[model samples]
Target: MVFKRRHKEKLIEATLFWIGSLTIIILILICLFLFRDALTLFSTHSFYSFVTGSLWYPTADPPLYGLIPLLLGSVLVTFGAICISVPLGITSAIYISEIASPRVASFLKPFIEILAGIPSVVYGFFGLVVLAPYLQLWLDLSTGQVALTGSVMLAVMALPTIISISEDAISSIPSSIREGSLAMGATNWQTIYKVVLPAALSGISAAVMLGMGRAIGETMTVMMVTGNAAVIPGMPEGIVESVRTMTATIALEMGEVPIGSEHYHALFAVGSVLFIMTFLINLAADIIKKKYRFKLEGS
Candidate 1:
């Protein structure tokens, strides 16, 4: 019986190992496929010009594939989403974790989870059908399908991730720390802001980073709302302008572009850029978390 139990344990271990290995292998295969197709575009296009060029006329006579406009659009949308979501998410998280009654916390958490579970398509549809008209009327723009509109929708989508993770982080803080701070004559707010927040800084930072990643990578909602113009907008005033993101460009054109053509290869190249950006963002998040954890431990 002991030998049979040991054999079962070994079988389970080997099965888990193969599952993990398979996931990594699939990821590597995807990267290989993406880069292999992406490199074909560079054969006829200058890498530097492709990246720095502002125009994205993929269907033009000569076909310009400059990525600057798309990159700028993504940056603008992500920046706006981060600015709007971070403060609201953190504040809500703190309230839920530290201030709310257990009943209230339980209610709010389920609602946030529901929000997260809502499909991206539904969010996109809401943005297109409801928010667009409202924004247009309020902003006095010809059309409301602009970068700011996408940003607002993306912020809504990112909020759940930020709030959930941050609340967990804040809740995970040791109860002893809070008691000690109060014993030292600190007010509840003071203890929360100074002691509790500092202790959970690493986790909160991770939440923010993950939220930013979600905002940056969101494709469907942004594509549906942003007017899909492939032009660089002027600074300061351009946040309200219609623009196209890299993901949007690929999604919009990939279906219609001829197979084995430059446009096809270029779309793959765009995907490759996006893949790299996501990888770098995740890597940076990890590095930031480690640095903060080290500091907290040292202190």
Candidate 2:
């Protein structure tokens, strides 16, 4: 019996050890795959021109791979998504954390999570079928496929992420803080605004950063809704004009690109830019959190 128990323990330990090792190896492999492309990008192109230029004509014999328009389109759509999502998400989070009854919270929280689980492709389909036609009629645009459509879709997709994170942030605030504010004759809303929000600002900021990352990386939905025009045709006036995004550019063109071609490396370079941008945003959030943490701990 003692020998059998010892063997069982050994087997368990070996299994766990192998699992951890395999996970690390898989992560390394993924990093190498992504990094290989980035290295190729640097080898093939001037980093300055690739990031800063305006044109992205990859099929052209020389392939002017300026990523500015794609970058602009991504920023525009992400900006629109943030505009739509932040206020709505924050408000919903506040309601869930501070205002909603437990029954209401129970009902709504899962629904919001369910919204998050809906695939991007489905969101794309919804945009194409339902949103595109409505926008065309309402905006009197030639085609409904535009940045606005993509923005709206991305906003919807980002909603659950923002809401969930923000809700957790709000919920993390100490009830003592709320009670103290109320003891000082503050209204519930006032207490929430003055005490809870200030206390939870770090986490809320993190949530926004996370949502921004999601907005930046989204591909299929943006591709489906944004009319894949590489050119923005002067300053973007409305959502009716076609736009192309970096992720979309990669998805659309990578398949056709010959192995080791300039266009292929250029796409990887664009992806690297995206990864760096999102990483910086997240790093900024972390810095903000640390700064606030220092203040909180010192006080």
Candidate 3:
């Protein structure tokens, strides 16, 4: 009976190990497939021009493939979303985790979760039918479908992630830490800001990074509202201008692009760039979390 149990345990361990290995293998295969098609574009297109070019007319007479505009559009929209989501999300998280009564926290938590579960397409439709028109009327813009509109919608989509994760992080702090601060004569707000917040800083940072990743990777919402113009957005008023993001560009053009054409390859290159951006964001978040966790544990 002992031998039989040991054999079953070994079988289970081997099965789990192979499952983990298979997941990694699949991810590697996906990366290979994306990069293989992406590299084909550089073979016929100028790498320098592709990276630095401002034009993106893939179906024009000569088919310009400049990537700067799309890259900048994505950057502007994502930055805007981060600015809006991080503060609001973190603040709400703090309230729910620390300040709010149990009843309020319970109510708010489920609402945020529901927001997270809502379809991205529904958000896009709302942005189109409701938010855009209101913005146009209020801002007196020629059209409401601009980078700012995309930012607003993306922020709404990213808020639930940032808030939920941050709340959990803050809530995970040892109650003794708060009690110690209170025992030291610190006020409630001071204890929260100086003790609890610092303790959960790693998790909060991770949440922000993950939220930014989601904002950058979002396709349907941005495509619907961001005007889809493939031009470098001018500053000071750029956020109010129509611009096309990398994801929007891919989603918009992939269907019509010829299967083996340079346009198709260029789209793949865009996907590769997006993959790298999200990968780096996640890597940075992981590193930050580990560094802070190690420091917290050591101290």
lDDT winner: 3
Give lDDT for model 3: 0.97
Cα RMSD (Å) between model 3 and the true structure? 0.9
The TM-score leader among the candidates is 3
Give the range where candidate 1 is weakest over 10 consecutive residues by summed lDDT: 231-240
Query: Candidate 2 clashing pairs?
Result: none
What TM-score against the true fold does each predicted structure earn? 0.97, 0.89, 0.98
Task: Write down the RMSD of candidate 1 (Cα, Å).
Answer: 1.1
> Which is superior by lDDT, 1 or 3?
3
List model 1 lDDT by residue over 107-193, tens digit each: 999999999999998999999999999999999999999999999999999999999999999999999999999999999999999
lDDT of 2 by residue, 30-119 (tens): 767776887787676787887788888887877788888888888888888999999999999999999999999999999999999999
lDDT of 3 by residue, 51-132 (tens): 9999999989898999999999999999999999999999999999999999999999999999999999999999999999
For model 2 the local lDDT of residue 24 reads: 95
Task: Please report, in order, the local distance difference test score of every candidate based on alpha carbons.
Answer: 0.93, 0.88, 0.97
TM-score order of candidates, top first: 3, 1, 2
